[model samples]
Structure formats: C-alpha cells, structure tokens
Target: MYAAVEETVQARLILSPHRSVRLRTVLSYLPEDPFAVSMAFPAEFSLDEAEDERSAEDIVWVFARQLLSSGLELPAGLGDVHVRPTVGRRTMVELRAPEGTALLRFDTTDLRRFLWRSRLLVPEGEEHLHLDADRALAQLLG
Candidate 1:
C-alpha cells in the first residue's frame, strides 16, 4: 500500500505582465486516487468568481498525474486546465472556466522535486497496481 504525498510550492499569480501575486499552492497525491493529482489554492483564487461568499477554504483542482508530468516538457491538457513549460525554467498553469481564469507560474525545479518524491512511493508505470477496479466499478454503478 502507498501513502499520500503532499508538497507546497510557491507560485505567482500572473494578473498581468506588470503585476503578480505570490501564492502558496499545495500539490497532493493519494494512493486511493492513483491516476490523479491535485492542486489546492486559496478559495479566492478559484476560477469561478461568481461565488461572492466563499468561506475560508481551499479550491482543489484534480487532473491526471500524466498530464502534469507530460506538461513539464510540452503543453498538456485541453479542457478546463492547461500546463506547459515557460521560459526561465518555470511552468505556466492555466485554469479556465466560463466565469474566469487564473494564470499561475511555478518553478520547474520545485515541480520536478515533488514529482520525484511521489514516484518514490508509487513509481512510474505502477499507478495501475494501486487502483481498486472493483471499487471504481461499484462507485460508477452505485
């Protein structure tokens, strides 16, 4: 059995070329959800701005772990989220929704370090071994 892995990396909220805000972004992986990775940000950084009364909470975005891995070298993802390497050894993450979008920049080294740590627990090509097919099928049919 694999344990959960979590890391917090500093990110820049690119509001504009001339302005940006520093944010603490949390990256998490759980053995139960082997195929996916999650990024959690402050609730205010949500892609949907329509919610005017948000309590103190986190907005978590879950996506394929492969998406984030491939994105480090080339662009990945096509739907509500996108990740790609940027100049200066940084990575750009775009969160898109009908209401709004949030652009974030993260250090490539930080991301790589976190991925490496996660691989130590689950390893590459071993994620499938951690999945419970029966539980997933039951959840789908329930």
Candidate 2:
C-alpha cells in the first residue's frame, strides 16, 4: 500500500520588509514519489503580479525531499528553488521563475512537523526501496 502526507501551513509572501501577503500553502509527499516533496499554492495566488492572468489551477513546485531536510538546518538548493533557515524560528523558501521570484516565509515548526510526518510514511534512506525504477525509466524514455 502507498501512503501520502499533506500538511497545510500558513506562510507570508515577503513583498518587502514591511509589506507581505498571507498565503495558505500545502506541503505534500507521497511514498510513491519517495525522493520528492511538493508545495502547492492557491490558484488565486499569482507569483507575478504583473502577469496577465492568475492561473486557473494551483501552482505546485516539486523538488528533492533531501533539499528541504538539509535546508531545515542550513541553506540548500541551487536553482529555481531554494530553502534555508531564518531568524525567529522561520524558514525562507525562494522560488524563481521567468515571471519573477517569490520569497515565502514559513514557520519552522510547521515545516519540521510536516517533514516528520512524511518520514513516518517513507523513512530517510528507504526511498530507494519504494521507487519504481522501471516505471521511471519508461517515462523518461517516452
């Protein structure tokens, strides 16, 4: 059987030091996709205010699970997505796209709790056992 973990967390879109927007973010992980985690934002939310339209569907960013874990303790990631710890029990996640960059601030406790719950489903170092390499290879080959 496969299991998935989803946690809803409150976050702040850091528009500026004084200006910010509150956002409801969903963090999710599935044992089937063992090595990755996903962050989904509301459809109404626009990463780029200057864009012509707000996406009708939720925006989800998928990245390595280990990157998030490492980020909890120190800065991690290189391009498109980056995660790092911040002052006052907060974590900063930077998402970069052609439209613009979105700087999100989340509570460290919330992220930690989410990660812990995901680990219960697919523990660290055991992801390889759950992965379907043949299926992945087939998808890539296609």
Candidate 3:
C-alpha cells in the first residue's frame, strides 16, 4: 500500500557525487518542524506489496539506510540530529538533536503517521488515481 510518490522541488542532492544518479526521488515534508522526514522510495522496497510482507523487513531497512545516506536538507537548530524509522521493527522513531555537545533524544510515534498521511494508499489493481487535491509535499514551497 505504501507506493512511492514523485514530485519536483528545490531539494539539492548533497551526498550524491554524480548528476545522473537519481534512482530514488525522496520527498520530506516538515513545514512546522523542518526536520521530520517521510522518505518514499521505490515500491519494491515497501513490505506492503510483498506476498510475505514479514520477510521483506530487511529490504526495508537496507532501503532506509541507503536513502538516509543520500542526504536531505536539514534546517538550523538540528546540529548532529537525525530522525529515522528502523525497518519493520520500529513503531516509533528516534528523534535526536544536539544541545551543547550533548545529544537530546525523544521517541515518537508521529513520524509513521505523517508518512502514512502524506501518501495515498490505493488498493492493488487500481490503474487510475484522480488526485484532485494536494498532498503533504505542497507545504514544501509554502
């Protein structure tokens, strides 16, 4: 059900060294927080589409790590901070930020909800999706 969605924005790929390496187009929406990331990768990475969804958990982890390593834009006040959900095992994500050389941590269930609400989960075999309204990515330019 978690299909990757694509759109264009001002996000510059920093970790990427080449111009032609665009396998995944990640979209992160954090208008209020400026740090929460809802990274969407190819459908092959989502366990939801697998016949044995539980077996595909490791693939999800690999994808998450690979995607995070590609580097997305981070706002100020997030020095040494990172937020990511761990594969199929995580119900909550670790929200970490640095303050005076020390890392502050908070476990939250919000990221999962954000990611779900950001994308529309169409049932399988649906060929057309008439999207008449905008999604979470609309907040990027606003």
Candidate 4:
C-alpha cells in the first residue's frame, strides 16, 4: 500500500496593486527525507501579461513550489523541476524538495483541488499562514 505523507511550509504572499502576486516560501523536510528548501518566487506566479484574472494553474504552481521548497532535502533522484502548464483538465509541476519530490496537480475543471489540498491534504494550515514576501524570504535565508 502507498502511504500518504503530509508536509507543511510557511510563506508570504505579496500582491501588488496591479494584482501581481509573489510567494516567498520555506519548506521543512521530514525525517524520512532530510533537506530544507526555499524558493523566492517560482515562474508560475509570473503574471506579466495576464489580463485581470489569475489563472488557477499559476496559483497551483505557487502553492506547489512553496510546499516542495519546505521539505527536508531536495530529492536527488528527481532529475529536475518539471512544469507542465495548462494541459487537458489539469496542470502539473514536479520537483524535488528537501524531504522528497512532489507532484502538484491542479484540476482546471474543479477548484476543489486547491481548497482541499490547502486545508486537508497538507499538514495543519496554521503552519502555512499568509505573510509578507520579504519576511518570508528572510526566514528562508536564515
């Protein structure tokens, strides 16, 4: 049987007046996978030319990168970060974190994936509360 593991990370979300958002996150790894990781702002959060609406795929990417970056050790087994933008019903990005590699899947047909993962699937939401980008980045560095 496949065992499911839940991990947590803390991050700050910066939203500009233009609606551009940046996420600074730190991922903490578990004993099973030992390496802490950090990401300043992954490309998924880049909304350069996007109109007013924020794409679910972008949001998912930010969350995924944030969570993965928190782990104990970035998995060496995973070659490199794999990002798949708007494809079929879901968008996915795969990358190694400190603990282990993570595959973030965002369902375009249902926003439930975002809400559920944020609330239930991941560790306690308290560990990943919202914060400022600069502060979050500082924590990652220190």
Candidate 5:
C-alpha cells in the first residue's frame, strides 16, 4: 500500500502525429472549459521520462501511458458540468453550480488516442484502439 501525500498535477500534451500524455500526479479536478489550460492541481506534483532514444514527444507520451495505466480512478460529483472540445486537442471542463464555486483547468491534445494507446501501453499494437481517455479525463476532471 502507498500512503497518500500532498502532490501536484503536472501534465503535458504532445503535438500531432504522436499525441501523448504525462503527469506527476493522478488528476483530481478539471475546469469547465476543455480548451483552456487553467486546470486545477494539488499544488504539488512531479513529472518523469526515461532516457530512451525516442523524441521528447515520444518520451512524454510513454511516461503518460505508464501513469495512466497505473491509474483507474474516475471522476465524481458531475451532474450539470459541460464538456467542450475545440478544433485543436484543447478541451474545456466547465461547471455551473447554483450553490458553490470551485475551479481548475487542464488541457489535453488528442486525448482519445492518448488514452487508448497509453492505457493500453501499445505504441504500435493497433490502429483502431477502442478507449476513451479523453472522455474519461474530461468527465473525471469536470
């Protein structure tokens, strides 16, 4: 078992052709706007990437995949929040509550591909992977 400690959420979204992900902590909260990069974090976290010969993007993706695979915690308390995906990989997590206020933001590029490939940890295993990392992130975060 692992003791829970204060941690930050550090995530990186790779560009096209090789969309990948990375983060130091398990994501907890997501802002309403999917495109805006103002997501909330625990204010304490870290990031990791190996010395593989792959490009920086590839490294980030690999790290992200490892983290995502190690994690399966989903989101909760999202009843009226809205999720919006822009033209680019940018996504927004929105919430319009009538009682309280809490906000945080994070952005992801090509989230579906990232989630499918990363969670599966199969870089070149399949072309039509069937997983929704993007939706999971948005719903969980939002």
Candidate 6:
C-alpha cells in the first residue's frame, strides 16, 4: 500500500507553441473571465508516495504525471515538463513551459475529504485549505 495525500482540484493552462507571450497578453485583456484559460485537471488522478525519501522533486514529478494524464491537452511537441513546488503555508505547484510557468495550489480540505471518501486516507477532524484554481490559472496565463 502506498501512502497517499489528499487530492486537490488543480487548474493548468496548455500553452500554444511559442505563444506564451500572446497567451499572457490575451489573459491580461480579458479580466472578467472566471475560468482561467490554462491547464485543467480531469476527474481522475492521484499521487503516490515514493519508496525512497520524499524529495520536492519527487513530489513535482508525481504531480506533473497526474496533470498530464488528466486529459488536458498540451501544445504540440512539448516535452520534458518542468514543475516547481512552492512550499509554504499554501503549497503552490508550478508547471514550467518554454514560454512561462503555471501555478496550482492544493485545496487541502476538499482534497482530504475526497481522499477519505476514496479510502485513500483516514478521516480526521475538519480542516480546510481553500485553493483558488481560477486565480492560479489566470496567473499562469498572465
């Protein structure tokens, strides 16, 4: 059995080929769109703990695989996905592309609930981490 953490709702943006600048410009122009035009996570995905020491790189790789396999389309010929995990009170997962980087924050509470329901983890008390998916996406595109 693998030790799994709660799964959160993550948003991402698929960049156009060498169009990171254009994408950011368009996002800047459209300020009213709630749904950020970036990468988005599909319904099914999970992260499993590594057998060795838990490094930040390990975590990012796990997250990148989940995001890529979550039915989100990427730009043509894009390879070697780079992800940076911003560790803090609010953990931000940053996906780096040739043009720019997309950031995703985890909804700790909702993810916990989902994990508990999925039997991935035992339910403790109520704790919450509100992840702003839209804002993160917007920032990514911007």
Q: What is the C-alpha RMSD of each candidate to the true structure, in Å?
A: 1.7, 1.9, 16.5, 16.7, 16.4, 17.8
Show where candidate 6 strays beyond 4 Å: 1-89, 120-142
Residue pair clashes in candidate 3: none
Query: Any runs in candidate 3 off by more than 4 Å, and if so which?
Result: 1-22, 47-142
- Top TM-score hit: 2
Rank by lDDT, highest first.
2, 1, 4, 5, 6, 3
Q: What is the lDDT of residue 74 in candidate 3?
A: 24
What local distance difference test score does each model get? 0.88, 0.91, 0.31, 0.37, 0.33, 0.32
For lDDT, the strongest prediction is: 2
After the best TM-score superposition of candidate 5, give how far the Cα of residue 5 lies from its true spot, in angstroms. 18
TM-score of each: 0.91, 0.92, 0.21, 0.22, 0.27, 0.25
Q: For candidate 1, give the lDDT of residue 80.
A: 89
Q: In candidate 6, residue 131 scores what lDDT?
A: 33
lDDT of 3 by residue, 17-131 (tens): 3441223434454322222334433444332443465453222111232223222222222334343333332321222322122111112233333344333333222313423
Q: What's the CA error at residue 103 for candidate 6, in Å?
A: 1.7
lDDT of 4 by residue, 1-142 (tens): 2122333323323243244232443222222222212223344544444434444332222234333322212232234555343445443445454444445443433222333343343444443433346865788899
Model 1 C-alpha lDDT per residue in residues 34-136, reported as the tens digit of each score: 8888999888876565656357578888988888899999999999889999999999999887777889999999989888888878888999998899989
Each model's backbone clash number: 0, 0, 0, 19, 20, 4
TM-score of 4: 0.22
What residue runs in model 1 are displaced by over 4 Å at the alpha carbon? 50-56
Give the lDDT of residue 19 in candidate 5. 60
